[model samples]
Target: MSDALSKPRSTPGTEPKPPRPVPHSPADDIPDGAQVLLAVIGIASAIALLVWGIPKGYHWARAQDWHHFTQWAATIDRPVHTYLAAHTTGLPITAASAYVLWQGIGLGSLALSWATGATGARLTWIAYGAATAWMVWDSSPATGRPVATALAALAWTVGSAFALRGLSLRPVIVNR
Candidate 1:
């Protein structure tokens, strides 16, 4: 027999090499347009809340008498922060410094969630829209513009529902 024909292709103890893993591409990390839009809305909403909504809310909370919700929030906060007096009521913060801290933490979290494609930021924004709509509905009689309020609430609710469907939980990879 010829030398080529006489030799075996492989030894019994040898094993075949495994296939290589596919390389990751930057394109794979790009989110869909709707997702990006939702992220933008969340970021904008968070900024708006920090800039305007929180200040207004803080003032309102201060002016109002102790409600059940405020009582509950205070009860929960009291244990966590003993420095807050028992009488210190209204949505867990009685001082101007608290608003600053709240704004800083809220903005940082929203930014992180947006950057990471976390479901939390989207969900929180959707909740805010829904809550705003509910509040509009509740106060419509006083506004004396029931039709406009109804329409606004409808838009807010529907928009938030659609956005909820677009929420994503993946960690976004930035393409440098």
Candidate 2:
């Protein structure tokens, strides 16, 4: 008998094996120094902003006159503040309070996102940093502190760059 006949008839169809998947490890989620710094900076900045903003928000909420609140908002010098002031002319104190509250929430979320290494946190952090940089650049000259302002802006930019680089890193978890 021929070798084929001796071996018995083989099936016409056979299942193909799938490629092996790469192994996943907890180490894959470890962030480097820059990412760690980004998280720390983001959390600290968020806390500071919240501390500074909360009282202002409370004051706005308690104030009777929206006009006064809007005026105060306009004086803040930030483009966002100015726009809010211009557009919320007839709104109640809640408008100002809501703006402040919104900032608090956004900052809080930003902090959490960085800490957790959330998927979109990097872009959000970068945007926040850029906005902060712009605000510093816009207002610092008036304070007569060009050098400090420049350094602050540079720091924000660097932080944003760190966030950008950290986009792919995930949150580290402890083994039980």
Candidate 3:
């Protein structure tokens, strides 16, 4: 027999190697243009919240209500540092500083989530829903419209859930 027929082509000892698995990439998992758009909107909204929080913090600080502001912030998951600072600082410092810290942290988180692609986009909406629910629950009594706030929160949660489906956990990549 010819050498080609008599010998195994791969090798005497080594078996054939399996092909390399394609590299898994987050960029490959982007769901669609809608997801990107939603991410942009989420980033924008987080930016707006940061801006809005600044003025509100300033107002509360001027009012000398660090204790009160801190209480509300705790409901919305403000970092522990805000609590420590609130205890140490006078109202003006606490107000401005807490706003910068809390909002900056929140916005930073949202921005990071958006940076992750489809999975991140879905996570952002889920986070937004939970945060909105917590904020509404915390503020409803003060706002004097518990029913309205509850309905609004429900609407927001539903809307966020609907938007979340725009992203797949592992999106099917269509090769053009």
Candidate 4:
């Protein structure tokens, strides 16, 4: 009776708990070289456009070459100026030139946004979308070309925004 009472209990069927997954910190996500590359590409493209496009537009405007201006303006897909030019004489080269200048501003903004990794890139997309939409709407009475242009611009803006957001989320690796 004493031996039976002193018997030890034995139950062995349960498995051990598994380890949890490691949580990633921001620092772990983005590499420094990637960040620098993003900044460089954005800034370089913007600078190149500003340097090339603006001067050419200004020269065209100053020369008062309506035909060349009209041709270039047509490439932008805005209906108001193109339509007005077709119907009447003396198309506004100054206005078209101004529009080109605004585009340069957008390019600069995009570069700054990319370099700073701020919300600036998002803002640039919004601006680009707005401009593209305006052109589409203005050209609605015209042919399908303007609509296609608008769609293309919309795609570009959305793609760029995604790219920028992805870059922002990446962790910047610090070298010690």
Candidate 5:
């Protein structure tokens, strides 16, 4: 038989060949615009909450409108409470304590998101996810607005996750 024919054919029946390591390309490694978009979404959402949400909350509080305040609080607090209640039951804790804990977590995540790196992206995902959950659960008169905000937050979370995963796959060359 000819050498070509005699040579052992590397076919499906034979042991599979080891995958060749692909040479890393800087272009291939770099993150796309999605990361920036996600980061921007996170920042804008946080700013909105701090600017509009906080003031609204304060207004409700100052007015001594317990009903409105509870509704507002539920919008911001209920999701976190629900998450905590589901995940960490049996722990002796008051609603105030839970709120504090959730706030701490949100703040920490936000801080990390501001810092440059993969941690920032991961933090953005977590912070946005929590915020989205909160908005969805809270019973607010501005229900339509919260729905839109929650959807935006969810988009940010998913986008950030994709960006972070992409970054992990290869070194991203970000333009300063």
Candidate 6:
């Protein structure tokens, strides 16, 4: 009672306290080496597909008289060699198996470009987006359910958005 009476009373009934500042989170921080490693892994994987997988696929397709017209070059989507894995026998390195590598050079270039801090970062997005589009088109069934292709496209789109956002935040330096 004495303390309350002696102390200056708040306006009417409300008492105002100092505003608390919002704390910043360092969780999003990524180390330079880690970023480089991630980029390298992505690039290397892509290169392996282009260098090894695509050539083998082309050869196989040629032997089997399948289309050899820029399969991976035109479109670099992942999750390959589905039919082979579905087989009852153990995974065999058949001609068809050679084409299983996902998102060949197209994806790899993008990774390398982003990793090395190369300029024109915005342009890489075209390849990033086109790959998903190509996959959607290639994977779509001729005349059946569209569930699988749709789901994959959706997932890829979300993933691409996240990756692109991460890249976009990077500081850009323009030469005047």
Full-model lDDT for every candidate: 0.57, 0.60, 0.59, 0.64, 0.62, 0.55
Best by TM-score: 4
Candidate 1's C-alpha runs over 4 A off are 5-8, 11-118, 142-145, 157-162, 165-176
Give the true-structure RMSD of model 5. Answer: 16.5
**Candidate 2, overall lDDT?**
0.60
- What would the per-residue lDDT of candidate 2 be over residues 40-113, giving only the tens digit for each residue? 99999899879988888888777756886564333333544544455567777655775585476546646756
The order of the candidates by lDDT, greatest first, is 4, 5, 2, 3, 1, 6
Candidate that scores best on lDDT: 4
TM per candidate comes to 0.30, 0.33, 0.29, 0.36, 0.33, 0.29
Candidate 1 lDDT trough over 10 residues, lowest sum: 78-87
| lDDT, candidate 4, 1-176, per-residue tens | 69877877555765556898899788667799988898999999899889998898889778884886565445555554454344345655666665565566567666666567567566775676566566555655557666556664755565567536546556899999
- Candidate 3 global lDDT: 0.59
lDDT of 3 at 160: 50
List runs of model 6 lying over 4 Å from the truth.
1-102, 113-125, 143-145, 166-176
Output the better candidate (4/6) by TM-score. 4
User: On residues 1-176, what C-alpha lDDT tens digit does candidate 5 reach at each position?
Assistant: 78898877776767877999999986675588866887899999999999999999998878784786566545545555555566556778865687676566555554455454556556565655656565455533455656644654655465555444435556779998
Q: Write candidate 1's Cα lDDT for 1-176 as tens digits.
A: 89999977898778678999999987568778867897999999999999999999999989988787665444323322333222246656674555345445535545544566457766565555444444444544445436534565555455445444546569889999
Better of 4 and 5 by lDDT: 4
